[model samples]
Target: AEAGRFFCTAGRGLEPFLAREGLTLGRVRRVFSPKVDCVSGKVFFRAAARPGELRKLRSGERLFLLLKKHSPLPVSRNRGKMLQEIKSLVIEEPKYWLDIISVWRKLHGHEGETDDVSQENALALKRKSEEETNTTSKRQKTEQVRAVVSEECQVEAGETCVAPERTSNQECWIESKTSSEFPPKGSGETPSANEKLGFSFRVSCRCSGAIAKILTSQEIGRAIGITLVKQCGWRADLRDPDLEIFVHLNDIQSVVGIPLFRLPLANREYIKTAGLRSTVAWAMASLAEISAGSLVLDPMCGLGTILLEAAKEWPEACYWGSDISDLQLEGADGNIRTAGLMDKIELLKSSVKALPLPSESFDTVISDIPFGKKFKTTNDAQLLPDALQEMERVLRVGGTLVLLLSQELRRCVDGLTKCAGGDAAEASADSDSGAAPAQASSVDGNSSSLAQGGGESVLSRRFGSLVPEGVYAVSLGKTDAFIHKYRKVSAPGQK
Candidate 1:
């Protein structure tokens, strides 16, 4: 049960959130990349710890146990320089490299057994990355290519006693070949590269960055692979590699690691259909901070991803999710049934703009609003406002509203303004005066929109709308989204 340092990658803005969760799971060491979109952290944990806990992490995309770090190296336009540096590092510390790979193998076992690599899923990963980038020219070159070594090659190892006859036969064949064909490194004896020399195993390199023009990643990968085979007498298994090395180079440095999991950890069992990513769903749920017995609802639930995630965290909470589409509701129902949370959840076929529920009933509402891209819509832009109004009506005073939205945020706040009963005059005056106009509540306890002074949009008025407690802007590769946490103000001025 020895502890090891590891790193986890998360959506750009949610690194802090993920880091906090990592702290709960283990001792978090560092959360780096403050300026860049890079959101990653290192954690220390026991090698014997259940990986299921890592899988439980909803916000992390990939996790890796640290092997070796080469920090602050000079940027090399020449691919050979970088390859030579990596080669020297590997050749100098071959034993350390072997030990790290061995320990990773021992802990995770053969990735082939648990790693779920399907044609469909792999393609999906590529497509998701492409979508995140949203730039076909750049994406086509980088994200689309899946780097894998082919199975047909091998590196020649010295003959053993058991293979005496074959050894003798190949020995004659070996004598005819020049020693310079594959020269041993660090002996100061320089040898030229030969094309005809066959290896016992094949190596593939996949290169990236400005240096890609000089050499491909696959070419660099092969060079390192060749060096390793020569130094350690290791045989390559490219098709189902005994060891798989990933080398990623940027303008700054190269990150190299042996993957412990074949697939990203976000591929949870409960995810039947894709909608909100489990990580984002988990972030929204965490920000909501719902209690065990709180009444939670997802009015725009599609496939119940958000509710399901919440249910996992707060099993005792009363969960209700409704979708405008019957087909989507059916899908959500199946997922709920598969999760064995039928007793813990309620599914309704209802629109977000008008839920078939009593006013101020839900203690908390969590939802991933339709950006009109994933789900088809007639009025793509109007959904957010209408949904906000309906949600505010159903959510009780001081209730939390956790929303994952991609666009039309201004309109969303505008809808919340009308829902709070704030009128155009008050909204305008609130904007011009740089002060919130006095709010007047109706007999039913709803605030009136009208206030003295300039006529501004309701979005301009503060306390007149739902009180925003937290806002997280999430950058998921090519996609941009936001998670907003709001507390319904207690019946206008009553608070």
Candidate 2:
């Protein structure tokens, strides 16, 4: 294993979780934790790692090498200067791009032929002489004209025309690329014998902070691309490039690296019926702390994502997934077999309100309940309270219960806690497990559940036996959700 600096791309609140999980690996060192100083979805560290080792990370969406960290950049509002600064910073840096390039190759299953750059585009010269000679010359002339017209249009539309731009498909893209699209050019200089050749790459920039106020991601990416093109021996290929570089720039600092894979680590190939992101699902399971010989249950498990995550991480424990919908149960069944965890996980058809299992039979209950989209509460009754009661009923005393719920339901539970004169305790934003138990909030007397045709309030009955353990805020792109941890007590109103 080679020692190298790297960073993992995490969710907004998952920085600490990722850092902690990353440290659990052998020969990994923490360089910087974003939540400790800056609030971002990245964990910077150094590792003596290979391609296969980092892909096992469950908390982060993607991983990148720490190519270089720039010095404090000015809070420049000048768009032209900012683009120029970005270009100069990249090209001027003394970089060993080959080191990161080797890692990128192994990640894509290209373990061999990494030594010779010419092997990358064996047809580069042949294609350049035959198909691209005349046509490539013509396209360059047309592209220059298009650039002028595009800038004029931008200025007329009240946008900044700081840099010349290429056509949409001229550089890199998601589609396949033909050799004719990119011909190796060297500004009339011939390639040296030792010079690396035919390495195609694309630059992707993400902008935030003060610098973003001046330049868009597109402008920054183009500036970097123009500099890379000056390398004189490589092609810019966005679609199926040999290397992919990423630049995450802010007003104060710039982070540059290469992405490990095309798909994020959160996308699970084993579980085809994934309902929740595996990273978040793994976070949910971590809260449960399923030790060896533990019995875990996901009463409202849809597609069994939570159960599958738990089973994979803690093979010593057994899991049961129950769902009311036959479609969801069938999906879960297929996923269990596909993951090859048939002996570790089991599936059952059941509703959240009632369980077929005996009381206090399970050691932990973890679930990501439906929060009103793709699935809904049946019979127009609230699903939270019924879920809490049934989950509490099956979980043994002192067993952990973890739930992933929306903000609306969280407020409803918070209101119940306040009514009982107990303040809900929130864990620190950067906590490793992302959950800590709050003060015990319980309501006295018997109360009816929504699923039951009785006169009892579901909220009152749900909070009586479970003591709040902790809450973690998680971001899911367009929306935010919270993970709540609780412990079931032997007696009602007991802490």
Candidate 3:
């Protein structure tokens, strides 16, 4: 029941949503980033009265149990003294660290457990990180690497990654590894550059900016690893760590933590062809204001990730998803079949600009428009009004329309013109988690304000009669996006 301050690494622009999840913790606050990488936002909060409520968060990319935070860490050009101080910081509160670990074990005891298909696959994914893999496999080489490659690997309670021990019986192995031995903080985590953890553990130090000029990440990791072994009785296991301790140092502050999971909190492994981050997908659906027995539609469903996410979260609804690409439709079909939700979801092949369904048939429509480098077009700005008009046409009176688009595209709304044809096949990727978009119907007798004091904004002015309910900025890797929620006021001139 003791309160704990936890740190979560969130996608840029998501800190506000994460902190507002009604976490039983004390007030959740944002941490300043040095802006080295696209590292935009960070937040920390103390949880006690309802620490269990932390599990309610879907926007946090990865969770870290904050062991300690050294704000305004004394930095020095003298590497030796700086290393010494950080080393001491590692073992400062051994008992408290152990207690935190215990809490972590309890809180996530069912981690890697999914109610949907593929629990084993999810667990397998969580059991290792790039830092844990001994050699890169052919499959892994082709896969897109995550923003942060954690050198710290995690294992289940009983499972262990056995490998030849790299350390002697020495209590502290103070190896002075060069920066080359460790990846940069932007790339990922630090120490025993080659040490694999099985029953053992590893220390990861993410050092950036001015801190790197004086101390290498490995130096910081080693300082912590050596002290952890000498004072805290933790074993070293880089390849298979029972515990992966993370220490991040920058111009702003130094943070030390233990990862609560091996994967992002929003990560869902039930479907492999998913476009857009699962967290983002969940947000878009939340803004739909879905109610039981309501009909929901995703016109540019891509691999059906958004619909899949919505169906799983709001099962009582009849879900329909359509896309123009045969290849994409096939992929979505497979994903839907694999998730075993065929009964609740319906998939069709149709263009977003001209949906096959009749007008005013569905209760809600949510879409993640194609934009940016991943899915680009010559005149993407020119495509919005047409697709949006089609979406409005099919939406029943007073229905909710949630759109996810790039901030760049949103800004280009002023010079909009209707383009012939539907969105390109490239427009099939998107994700979101929201203000419960599809909660009790916002389309009832009166519309629900997306936020307490929400009013007409961006999409409302450029398009038809869709009134802007709420809009939230979201960070998708290098791309900046927004989730827009709207309710039809009078079906575009019905008034």
Candidate 4:
């Protein structure tokens, strides 16, 4: 099989997230508008216009093109309307060119007309008319051109027209012309073309909810030229698609598309839960950025959601997940096997504080830190702190740690970090001003609290009691606590 393009979709307002990781906007190929499903109260991907001048593109180059062509409209009713309008344009104007000399002769006696004009004038007029026809016909092939014009815009049937290649400078004017005037006057439109076009591409994010939205949004899939052939339960993996589109829906919208072969997260079994949230996927992919070839450890793996996502995101790395509950591990194992990723992951049973792995082996650690009333621990207070110490011991000197917890558990993490010889600090120091901490209700039936205050206060309060300052001395530990701090790193000697 040929190697496919590597496509990475982003969430709304996440272009900056990709940019910070050294990815540029120019690498994207298309961005769909967002649509809301009235029945589900959920948003989905809508089809979008494909960027022009992509005929020569290699499969790998399309993702950047998608990002560069992102929609400018706000992802709301306004965006839905815009999608409708663009689709209408494509359906109404489907334009095509045909050699029209014979048709012109049939319509208006070609020999007599040529004889009447001077030889030079005949040639000039022919050239001029052909130029006009070429311009008009070229528009028919464009998405916008097809949207607006209906009648077959062809040269007289027997006439031949050749299109001259234009420079990049000339392309802008041509695109503008096609977008504005491809369909000149009256033309019937097709309903299929007008149906809101949706496009999506597979992204690095491994969240299930985000994946579901992409699979269900026909508009988004069609825009990127991907067809969802099947939807069995929450996960559908299509093999014979031109591209795989991923739609990320929030209050905001982001759509991405890439050719089928470049789909990094193709295995559905890797998605542990059908109801995984988009935020969690974003967090997993972001955390994958911290280490190279480092083993990831998740003590409270639950259904192995984080481990599965991490394994896909970092294929070069190994993953180990353990849980106290055998039922959750069984589900996780099934998911891993279903995804065909069992080779990359190892699952075991272990308590939070007493993991089977050796110390100083893991380079990065991440977990969803269980909470809520459903999960009862004999000593809830001691559980979190002890887990933190184990993580510290297992993680290498220059390693990284990421934990997802409720606001109340923040104090535990802080106290543990301090006890582990690192300063207690919030990871949001670099967050945009006035940004609220991301909030998600507990899946295990616990009340949720917003993560406010700085890292110190949040952690202190969550874990109960303030951790002593200077308990752990900061040595070579540089805390990369910012959410967007996961920068891609080259292997030790590679350029």
Candidate 5:
């Protein structure tokens, strides 16, 4: 029979990821099992069969497979025998002379006969035995020749040799074979040398069990011709480090060196700052082209986390953060100081409804508004509308606004914006007293109305024609858990 095919399955939520990684539907012939997460109700794909052509797989190959529902379940039973078989096939069978002899004995028969018949039979048996022995020897020789040819082909093609080592352990066999051909010792060489040259050294440790420790800086420095001096030591920056090495220490054996380009994570210091949750910063940064020297404004700046991250990411930016609470401002100031970014940021205590800066003062506005019953607010329904208007007022024409709003507030904001002139036309016009009145009909061909009687006549007149159009409703739970970005567009003539 032909050799069995290799099967692989995708991790949960990794089907699209696998496709992106170039895994086509046709490549996966069979799937054997699923990895089900009982708690999360998530399912992962798994391969049904061990790959016979293991050398073909890349380090991060995305494989697909189908599983037979009633396929033999994996168990401890016959495990030893199966492992022994694989070992014999991959490593011990350089020549199959002994196996050939065993087959020959099985083909012949044991019997008794009279003296005359016995003599005749003995002669026949002798001839038969010689023929069988010669045939078997030739077959063995042929296999040996093929094995050598295959080895050469693998080396020339840069294919891995997957011969087993220490019959009982699978991981040990793979590591032994890999190390024999491409040892980690001279991994510091340039890519060209690595591809062309051959090294004699091999990894001594077994590749079994959990990875314990990582390689020390001293070991890595030694490999790369750098001396590690603890006293006059260099403090390496992980972000742009030249080399990273991992040292794994086994309970029973000495430490081993693993060279890598990326370093292991040391801690979550960046993620755990006072007001600047890493997730929130990441969300805000994704909304716009935040570059060095850009202007960033956070109106409802609690703890200044967004500003801190913006300063770090866009070091050339003028970061402005403001909060209504003095206590929050104090905390934000302390955080900014601790980050060593005081020079890069400007902090102020101000109301979101009435920012101290002039109109169109910032290139981008990003904020996470307060929410829930526990959150304190000046006015329940008016809070979001007022903050959004302020955000529109401060952001430059065409600048982006990324907001984190509660489901209830998001609905209210959307309602007001949809009903209020669709774009920032009126808002922009109000910023300049020289601008003309809004057109009687909006871009959407809807008739506009001028409502009167609010204390803030400027805002009332600006949004009066649009607020009656429709109620904007946003369902927080229904909305995808992601940052929402909106661009500010000038109304006609206001541009």
Candidate 6:
């Protein structure tokens, strides 16, 4: 095993949360790239780690072992120069010596070349090539060497590593059975060269740089693969391999690594019914700020994603998830059973617009409301207002309601204003902006009057009127989707 630095990536807006999760793995180092859509962090875990430990991560979409991080090139260069730069970095870093040595060991598996046999062949070829006109046989060796180095480029840049020929075909990623984390053995304790592990590798490249404008991603991948294979004697597996390297190159910098986790950490095995992405669900739970033993409710719980995430984070808290759809409730039931959380979570059939629960019954309320697109019910026009009113009615003063929705801002504002007892007509007339709201329409899967309407600030004012205590919307990049956080206050005119 070798000592390695690793990084984890997440969706946009989830970098902070992913970084927080990474801290639990080891010392949090640096954010790899801030400008990219992905959030990545450098983490140092000094001891040997097992796959089980990484599987526990909640917010990360993918994890990779950092091979190198370099400053962006001053000017776009030809493939030859780029290959030269990569070779230099690997050469200067002794830590990469093990990687290169390991590359030779991996070659033993492909053509039945043993460790001793393969090195002897490479060295013999090396000598003969220096004497000859780089024979056709020598060129074949050079291509393999180049492929290994190109794979290094992929690992350097934090993009997937797949064989150049196989890049067009789907790649089957392989996980390491032996741990990558281990203290360097003393020279006396180190195994001989013959005993080292074998690994197959592929190089993948993503380009957002000036050079990228000239080179297609495939061209870059092919060139790097050819050079790396020729130089390192690394084996290439187009289908299944022991390792996959990645490269992400932008105008600002290049990132590379070997991925650790087979899938994003967000995909929990207990999830039988998947609705929102686990990352989104985790974010919703985090925003709710649940307290110990707090009573929480998701009135429109589609598949109990929010409740499941909250229950995992705050096991002591009581959770209640209800939905008007029997099918969805049944799926939530299966998931709850799979998680062995039937005792911690209560599932029921009920509509958000009219809950069967008592008023001020919950300490926290979090939900993913129908965007009026996928979650169309009978009274689509009045659904948002009705749900908000019910949520407010059941939430205790000072309780939090974190709601995710994708609808027109004006329609949402109007709905909340109406729910807060403000006359929609009066509120519209009082507006000095004089921007007419869009007519009701269907977007995504939900129906609402949210469209290309004016009066952008309407959501803030409407939230103020409804919550009174506090309110804010966390944008999720999409114009329609947002996580709306609201703290309940005494109803209008109450002391």
Tell me, by lDDT, which candidate is best: 2
- Cα RMSD of all models vs. native, in order, equals 15.4, 9.0, 15.2, 17.4, 22.5, 9.8
Report lDDT per candidate.
0.57, 0.65, 0.60, 0.39, 0.41, 0.58
Cα lDDT tens digits, model 3, 226-273, are 455434434565544556777777777778777766665676767867
**lDDT (C-alpha) at residue 17 in model 5:** 25
> Which stretches in model 2 have alpha-carbon errors above 4 Å?
26-39, 93-95, 99-111, 118-162, 165-197, 378-381, 417-462, 492-495
- Clash total of candidate 6: 48
lDDT of 1 by residue, 1-495 (tens): 555556555667777777667665554433232222232332323333545555666777666665545553355775557667656545544346445655675667544553322232233334434544475633443321211112223223221111112312212111211111122224554433421121222332334446565555444555565555434434444433344555554444455555456566666677677667877888888888788789999888888888888898889889998987898898898888888899988988877777899988999988887665556453534354457767877888878888776535433443444434433324321232123333423334454443234344543343454765555678755778777677777764463
For model 3, the stretches where C-alpha displacement exceeds 4 angstroms are 1-4, 22-40, 46-56, 104-199, 376-379, 414-462
Estimate the TM-score of every prediction: 0.68, 0.76, 0.66, 0.42, 0.39, 0.69
Over the stretch 1-495, how does candidate 4's per-residue lDDT look in tens digits? 211123333333333333333222233533322221211111222323232222112111113222212232233344344344322211211111011222222222244553322332234334334544686643333323222211222211111111112222322111110010012222354425322231111222111233233332333322222111111001112321112333333323343322222321222434655423323434544644445677877778878777766676567888888899988888888888877887989989998888888867877777766654345543444466567667666765556666655444543344333322223233333222123332333445444343333453444233222222211111111211223111111222222
Off by over 4 Å in 4: 1-9, 12-293, 371-382, 411-495
Tens digit of per-residue lDDT, candidate 2, span 102-134: 556665577765456644443333333343357
Residue 255 Cα positional deviation in candidate 5, in Å, after optimal superposition: 27
| Whole-model alpha-carbon lDDT for candidate 5 | 0.41
Residue lDDT tens for model 5, 118-200: 34334433433453458774454334423432332221110121221122322211122112112334346454432222111
Count of backbone clashes for each model? 26, 5, 29, 53, 18, 48
Candidate closer to the true structure by lDDT (higher is better), 1 or 3: 3
Report the Cα lDDT for residue 263, model 4: 24
Worst 10 residues of 6 by lDDT: 174-183
Segments of candidate 1 deviating more than 4 angstroms: 27-48, 109-215, 410-465, 493-495
Q: Report residue 492 deviation for candidate 3 (angstroms).
A: 2.4
Model 4 clash number? 53
Error of 2 at 117 (Å): 0.3
